[model samples]
Target: MTVRVRFAPSPTGMFHVGGARSALQNWIYAKQQGGVFVLRIEDTDAARNKPEWTEGILSALDWIGISRGSYEGPYFQSANAGEHRAAATRLYESGRAYYCDCTREDVQARTGSQYQGYDGYHRDLGLGPGPGHALRFRTPDEGSTVVVDLIRGEPTFENKLIEDFVIARGDGSPVFLLANVVDDMTMGITHVIRAEEHLPNTPKQQLLWDALGVKPPVWAHVPVVVNEKRQKLSKRRDKVALEAYRDEGYLAGAMRNYLMLLGWAPSGDREIVEWSVIEDEFRLEEVNPSPAFFDEKKLRAFNGEYIRALPVSEFIDACQPWLTGTGTIAPPPWQPEEYDADAFAAVAPLAQTRLAVLSEIVPNVDFLFLASPLIDEAAWTKTMKDGSADLLDAAIAAFEALQSWDAESLKSTLEAVGAERGLKLGKTQAPVRVAVTGRTVGLPLFESLEVLGRERTLTRMRAARLRLV
Candidate 1:
């Protein structure tokens, strides 16, 4: 059989980071097996599904190397309603499933607890298909179901403990479990590699596959991604959207590399590796089944390394979106005409090393472009203290007299001015840095001053001095 793996995601909201991880895994696995990768939009949740959300899924998959048209049908699960319904009917006709009219309150009244699920009350009652009648599978009362997973070892679920789940709702529409299995069967999905949270429903899906006279796909349940507190990453709580990271200046290469390392790592002692290396070395069997922590700090560090690794030309191009407020990125501090490309190119190398993400480029270089520096009140309150006017006076006088207006000369001149006051370069430049950059922390002080030019730098200092008075 041709190995076919599908990434079936619900078009409900943002393309989740965990779902992105699973998609990449599925994409790679299909390639490794010389199989086909299928993109199926489980657009069944009508209440929440939207066209834009489906497009977002396609766009997200494209962003992470699973480009459009490189894979099989972006088949919609809703489009296969006939097949889903046909399978449910077949299951009912074959005695593998039965119709039930028991309501939630009726089941709870009988079972004596709300936590207890369907009691299979109508299993042998032979309630025919009618309004308010639901179809449920007849789970075997004896043996256990063993799910053969590649990453996790075979997990066995006893038949007695496994409840007969609903295949179709009272309205005759198939529910997720049955629809999911039917869709997989229709598309010939050979392997179901997905997040570990789905492991609980695997036995049910596997049972559906068996009842439909089709063999179940091989399973691989990757570890669930968690936050620092070890809680499963939630949409409402965590920054789980993949698009947010992309828009925030995360390089696709860095994201793909870091995401793959959530539960598995490449050979040797390195977390950061190339895409080609990851594609070659990734194995489902080697993936750890333990919960993987989504360390935002570590991913940021990884992105910094990636940003620094880029050639100056590529880095400049990469920063354009965030620089000019393209798409969803907010506009920079400076206007279009105010932004000086030449000045930015000069400080690009310095800024490259300091950035964890590309969005940080705007603030670090904002002083160079703006007509006047955007001062930080806190930095001003901290740095513009006793005798700062005198220091600015002396520094401005010394700088105004300079023949050479460059970084090295600028640094030596400032150092001399600080030495006269019995201060070090750090103490001396703190005031100058705040006067110019509007922040206590930023790109190097002397280098930024060099790029800011002699006249503008002095004007800002004088402005800061006037503010002090």
Candidate 2:
């Protein structure tokens, strides 16, 4: 049988980081098995579904290298409602399932405990289907169902412990559990590689697959992604959106590389490796079954490494979205006309080292393009203290007389000015840096001054000296 796997996501909100990880895992597994990767939108929740959310899911998948057309049908689950209902009917007719009118209150009244699950009150009742009737799978009371998983070992669930789950609602529409299984069966999925959160429902789904007279797919429930507190990463509390990271200037390669390391690592000592390396070495069996922590700080550090590893040209290209505020990125502080390409290219290497994300590119280079430095109030108050007025005067005079305006010449020139004041280069450049770049710290001071050029640098110094007066 050709190996088939599906990445089914509900188009409700942002494409979650956890969901992205699952998609990548499924994609890799399929590729490794020489199988097909399917993209299925579980847009069955009509109350929460939107067209844009579906498109966002597609775009996010594309961003992570799961490009459109590379995978099978983005076959929507809603489109297969008929199949879902038919499977529900077949299960009921075969004695594997039955209909009953049991509300939450009714079940609670029967069991006398709100904490307990359904009491199987509807199992043997020959109640005819009606407006209030719900279809539930009649779980066997004897043996346990063993789910063969790739990452996790065979997880056994007792039939007695498993509740008689509802397959279809009172309105006769199939619920997610039945619809999911039917859809998987319809698509010929050979593997079910999903997050560990779905493990509880696996036995039910597996039962559905069996009752429907179809063999269940191979299962591999990867570890649940958690936050620093070990709580499952939640949209309300955590920055879990993949698009948020993408828009923040994270390289796709870096994001995906870090994502893979959430539950599994490559062979040997390195966590950061090429995509080709990951594709070659990734194995579901090797994945750790513990909860994977989504460390944002580590991811940023990984992104920095990725940004620094980039070829200068590629780095420049990558920074464009944040640089120009194009696409989904917000516009930079400077106007479009003020952005100087040659000047940015000159300082791009210097800026590249300091940036952990692409968004930093704008602030690092903003001072170079603006007509006047966008001074930071606190930096100005802190740096332009007592000898600053005198220092700017001396530095401006020294800079004006310079024969060549380069980073080397500029550094030596400022060094001498600071020396004359019995101060170090750090002290001397503090006022100059803030007088130029809005921030106290940024790209190498001399390199930045060189890019800013002789005229603009002097004009800014004179402006600073006047501000001090």
* Steric overlap count per candidate: 0, 0
Put down candidate 2 lDDT per residue, 87-178, tens digits, no spaces.
98899899998999989999898899999899998778798778979999999999999999999999999999999999999999999999
- Compute each candidate's TM-score over C-alphas: 0.98, 0.98
Q: Whole-model Cα lDDT per candidate?
A: 0.92, 0.93
The sequence of per-residue lDDT tens digits that candidate 1 reaches over residues 20-124 is 999999989899999999999999899999999999999988888899999998899989999999999999999999999888899999999999988888989
Candidate 2 worst ten-residue window by lDDT: 121-130
Question: Distance from true position, residue 236, model 2, in Å?
Answer: 0.5
Superposed by TM-score, candidate 2 places the C-alpha of residue 213 at a distance from the truth, in angstroms, of 0.9
Candidate 1 at 251: error in angstroms?
1.1
Steric clash pairs (candidate 2): none
* TM-score of model number 1: 0.98
Query: Which regions of candidate 1 fall more than 4 Å away from where they truly are?
Result: none
The predictions' CA RMSDs to the true structure, in order, are 1.1, 1.0
